[model samples]
Target chain A: MIEGHDLDYVVSGIQTLHRVSIRAEAGEIVCVLGPNGAGKSTLFRLLSGEIAPRAGKVTLLGHDVTTTPKDTLATMRAVMPQESVLSFPFTAFEVVMLGRTPHATAGETMADRAIARAAMAATDSLAYEDRTFSSLSGGERQRVTAARVLAQIWEGEEGRALLLDEPTSSLDLLHQHGLLETATTMAERGCAVVCILHDLNLAARYATRVVVLQEGRKVAEGTPREVLTRALLADVFEVDARIFVPEGTEIPVVVPRGPLSKTKPPRLATGALL
Target chain B: MTMAEAPTSRPTPRAVARPFAWATSRSFVLAAGCLVVALSVVLGCAVGAVHVPPLEVLQSMLGLETPHREMLMSIRFPRVALGLLVGSGLGLSGASLQGVFRNPIVDPGFLGISTGAVLFAVVAVVLGGHGAVSTMRTALGAPLLLSAAAFVGALVAMLSVRWLATVEGRLSLTALLLSGLAVNTVAGALTGVLLYAATDVQVVTVTFWTFGSLGGATWGTVLRVAPIFALGLVTLPRLGRSLDALVLGDAEAGHLGIPVERTKLLVIVVSALLVGAQVAVSGLVGFVGLVIPHVLRLWAGASHKTLLPASALFGAALVVLADTSARIVVKPAELPLGVITAALGAPFFLALLLKERRRLV
Candidate 1:
């Protein structure tokens, strides 16, 4: 439902994403995995139309993202950014209701409220419905935000897409699994789900397809069993890792041993040593 | 898994009950606001220099004959109406601008919108020659010209401040405050330069006007500026949803399908028009916009849908009541409307600064 073709993005004369082409079709959970500064967030931004790619184009539901009206695009897709800073002290329920903004209505209706409540329940955030969002813990806030995007695409209409950026970063282990299971549920409902993830095992467990990135380039793309090998992890992430697939299952479990030895320490884009 | 099916199943009773709570509270605030405006208007008319009494004031409003008919209709009524318009205009502009900027502290006065309007209005009066001040009352087209000039000035100042605060599509609150200070300083300096060249009579007129008053209010003045204020009142509330979306940073607001830049532009222009026309009639009334919205937000929460209209009503009442006190505080001599508002608003502003300091630090 969402496609980015030959995408190239640059910031401050440095390329952040180069020649990256990716697509998520209906009933697919495409997990994008990469190390720090691997251009995953940049790719997410490009697909969500937050920023235009310098080269190539993006299409969502068969319409050019750049040419489409934002209101029209919003109805077909919902994006959850890595972090959101709210200026005012809106209640969690109010924050979730914002997800229904793209729908055609002047104000919140009974149906919108029901959908928002359902989304909150799904994310385990209904317990704090009346609490101010700023008062919530980091994981609580993350789940509330997750509920917002879920509320946005609650209709489960065909050709819809949900794009999540590092949604699990602030989540605890159980909620992390809960959020991914929700994504899987969305995929099963015939919605395209593109998620950027840091945990390989979670990606391996939930992703129908995996796209791995290394230094602004797409290094691997296939099913987790075909693409998530120890050699790929060593080459892209610079880590010694083992991939174990149990005898009865096709799912691969990744266990990292340690960082791979290198001649030099890692450097940032600005050449600052880390 | 049970939660996943909640969309099709009935929501908890508590979930169904909560939205009504906010809705009812909002309605109460709005209703109280209307009552306050009515009471302020009555008190404003009755407690003036002539002391018309509430009964007679109500009679006068109903078009009955009273001893103070000419005084009430010609002087006090227009003044009270002007106060309402100016107060509500400031209040609405402040609320809308604060929402658009996503900052609670910034208002028309702080951002130099009022000063810009004053600068241009002063220039029009001084350049229009010796009789221009009096012409504002007598000449039909003079107030229109002055309002237009003020509108242009306000638009320029608002746009400049927005431009200075924005970097890489992000609006920095620190930059917004600093740029506002810069704009206010430059506008004040320019007004000072104009004052240096004025006659003694012009100086007196300019000084009194700059202090901000509804003393110059007339039916004609009210007629001229009321349409602009009404226009803002109608249009700004419609933008509440967009502004609500905007409170969640720009990119996220866009993700919700708001046209962020366009909404910002509309807010700027409409608020400029409101403040410009208001300043032309009421001078630089400080803190009505800032204080009104801040107070309303505290009472009604931060949703602009309620905040905008509530600000308008409460702002009108506050200004009208302030104007009445301005009339009675010094007794028969009348204080400038700006002095009373500043007296009330400055300390409130200080307290707000302290509250925000915790967050900033």
Candidate 2:
């Protein structure tokens, strides 16, 4: 079980997490969804021990480790940051083997290789295990990064817990769906998964539950049907939205509406990638 | 060379030895490095005003029968030994510094460690410890104060850089480069100040030191530098995996459970100690570390496990050959060792910068 008690994350002048609360039992895929500048990445950093929470408690399996040392915290969970600009030309397999660090003394063991290979296979990245990571495409790098996180989380009988910040950002359309499908499957098999996603369709499809954040605070969270609503989108995201249900699916499919229909939109910025 | 197979599935000959195997393509690199070091040792011994022969040089080196006792025994061996030691030391230090800094353009001089050594060496000579240039001057029964100062200076420079440019021990390249430039310029000015204030005799001695010669080579100097090289080579390989792991950036290295701060500190100190000792003895020979690693990387895949050792051997060869050429180029009146290194190094540096056109940030 992974649970947070009064977690708070702040960056620069912004509070990224404000008394955010959450819990994940034995088997569940809890996806966090938010718009740009919503502070999801900051929360992942705090949970991974990449950065310390301003005030709150984080406990896994009944042990308090909010202030645990980095290596110590690594033993309990694994996190994949948004950017993966590695400097050297490490092989894909060698890159994944880094997940074995916290375990120590497990290098080249049968168990280690099996778990690493399985993680790669799970994300369909096993075929390129021998290739240099630098030569991979953006989507391939995303899958490999996800595989590394999975390998780390499953290192021992600890049963694995994963925390990712926009892990699908660089992936292509097929890879995006493939990766989320695998992650959802793993969560069903009893891994506590917390993934930050920008795509509402993916969240609605794969998440057992959904978390909505605006600014730095948690605005809504419940079943996919309950959180993926037009009312919450406008109130929190400040954008008009519509919720659709496809046939027999209980999860709502979300689509956003523009402000142009109500009032003239603000001028566009030239430097923006969007 | 790019890996021919995956680390796991490759047979024992490749997989088990991936961390240690020397690639077939790099055999030339290995041989070129070896051949130069060998040629330098023989030629350096035979080509003085005394004009010893190649055979006699070999005999003396092998501890076999010798013709002239004093010429072959005392003078020649010490010079050859010192050349090999200082050469290899400078090379390894340069390679390790480049890896730690993670910038292809970086070399042993980046953190101002070598400049710091030079500054302290000048200070020691200027302060009138006339008998204490303490490096090769050990034959003259000096205090070794020069080397002592250089070591302290190198350590201080490395520590200052580590403290300022690293945020919680995660080195920021921008900060590191900026700090290196700042520290190098500052340390270099201190050297100039000392040189300006020195007496005529001190100035001459300092000039020769700055030129960096194996001419000052002696058994005692070899003794002082030997342990540092051994310590660095031995310790650096232990961090091969850590260094390789570090390429994934600090956050990734940390995720892999490496103590990033501690690893950076070790690399900096080891590089400083190694480079400072060589500079104290050889007088700031540049480019041995800078050019060799890149050249080797083009041949050997970017795995530090193999890269570190190969670079060390290659670096050792570069210095020994450059020092040898420096000795013979103006034999009766030797050119500065620094001059030879620059002649060899500058061209290579320009080429590397140009060829790395795409990788330039």
Candidate 3:
């Protein structure tokens, strides 16, 4: 389990998040949806222990995350940023092997290599293990990086959290669903999975629970059918949209009509590719 | 290099070598580098002012031949040992520093360690006169005052750059690199001022600070430098896995459970020590630290596990060969070791840049 209460973050004297309360339980997927500069990535950074909160309490696996050592916190949660840039020519397998760094005592053991290979297999990236990471395309690189994070938490205890920031932004439609399915599988296996996504339909289809944010405040929080209504869409995302459940589907599907006004063009690009 | 075939349902070579076999493709390249370095060291000891045959050199090394034992032991062997020590120190420091910075082109001197050491050494010569220097050398027997001052100067420069770059517990790479440049410029200016204030005889001693050579090698200098290099060797090779993780950005490395700040600090301190020690003995021999690692990375892969040790071996080889050429090229009057290194390394570096440019475009 991962929980944060009364979380407030200020960056460069601007309040990014104000009095936010968020939680992720085992065996569930919690998706965060927000517009540009809505503090989604900032929240992920706080949860990952990359940065400390100005005023808040963050607990991971029943321990105070702020006071816990980084190595101990690293064992409980894995983070996948938007992009990981490397200067050297390391192969995909070697990159994944680096995920075992915390567990490795002296050097890489045979068991570590096996776990890395298994994680690659889980991500469907085993075939390209020998290829250099820089030579791979965008989507392939994303899967390989996800494999690295998977290798990090592969053998952890229950309630380990996997946090992803814009994981499917660069992927195609099929790959988008495929990647989310992997997260759902992890959720089913008793891991707390939190994903920040821009696509509402993908969030509605995959998220067991959804939290909507606008201007750093939690606007609505509940199931997808409760939180993803037309009024919430119009008020939070500023879009004219129709929400309905199709014949064979159990989740809501949104069909956006257009922007509310021509002055405010639709913000389609998330700028998370870098 | 033939790519290992992907794992199949059947057993593979990687599986067979998983538990016991330590040799990979990178290890093969390292083994080859060790052979070349060993051969070069042996040949380097043979060709000096008096050309001892290679076989006779080997026989004397085993204590069988005593005719030229004094010449080999007293002069040539000490010089070769000094070259090996300084070369390996520079090479290993270069490789490890590049890993810490996550840049392929950076050398050990990127943090202002070399220039800082040179500046303090110049200060030792100019401010401390010939009488003072000789007195200290005779008392301590190894030029300890100059080297100790140089080490202190290097540590000061590195710490200043770190302090300037750090903000709110985070070290910015851009700030770190720029502060290094700033410190180097200041140290270089101070060195110039000291050179201007020196006497004529002191001027010659201070000039050697710029153009390095191995002509001044003695058993005393060799013994003094050995402990510093020994400490470096023990600490540096063990940093391979940390460096491998650090090649990814620091945030990524931290998420992977590495103590990013601690690892970065350790690498910076250790490499500065190694580079400072080399500068104290050899007077800023250039290009071996910068070029040897690049060439070795191209030959082997860029995994620090392989790249670090291989760089040390290849670095030792390159310096031995360069110093040999420096001693023999002009026949009696020796060229500066730094001149031969830059001349050889600059062309190779240009070729590497051209190759990389082609690949980039």
True contacts kept of each: 0.53, 0.26, 0.43
Sort the predicted structures by DockQ, highest score first. 1, 3, 2
Model 1 chain A poorest ten-residue lDDT run: A263-272
How do the residues B98-165 of candidate 3 rate in per-residue lDDT, one tens digit apiece? 88867665654666778898888778766765567533233124456667777777878878877887
lDDT of 3 by residue, A165-227 (tens): 999887878768767877777777778988999999999999999988889888889999889
Report model 3's TM-score to 2 decimal places.
0.89
Best by TM-score: 1
Per-candidate DockQ values are 0.47, 0.27, 0.37
Q: Over 4 Å off in model 2, which ranges?
A: A10-14, A63-76, A91-94, A100-121, A125-132, A188-190, A259-264, A267-274, B1-59, B68-72, B128-131, B134-144, B159-179, B356-361
Chain A vs. native, model 3, TM-score: 0.93
Supply the DockQ value of model 3: 0.37
Give Cα distance to truth, residue B183, candidate 1, Å. 1.4
Q: Which pairs of residues have clashing backbones in candidate 2?
A: A87-B247, B1-B299, B1-B300, B1-B301, B131-B142, B132-B143, B134-B144
**Chain B, candidate 3: TM-score:** 0.84
Cα lDDT of model 2 by residue, B1-361, tens digit? 1111222222322124354445433455557667777777787778766778898888877777777657866887777677777766776676676667776667766667778887877776777564544234542234245566677788888777767788765667667767888898998877778877776767766676666777767677778667877888798866766776677777777766677879988988887777777777777787778877777776666667667777777676666667666766776777888888888889998896686556644
Regions of candidate 1 where Cα sits further than 4 Å from its true position: A263-274, B2-24, B130-141
Scanning candidate 3 chain A in windows of ten residues, the lowest lDDT window is A260-269
Count the clashes in each prediction: 0, 7, 0
lDDT for model 1 comes to: 0.87
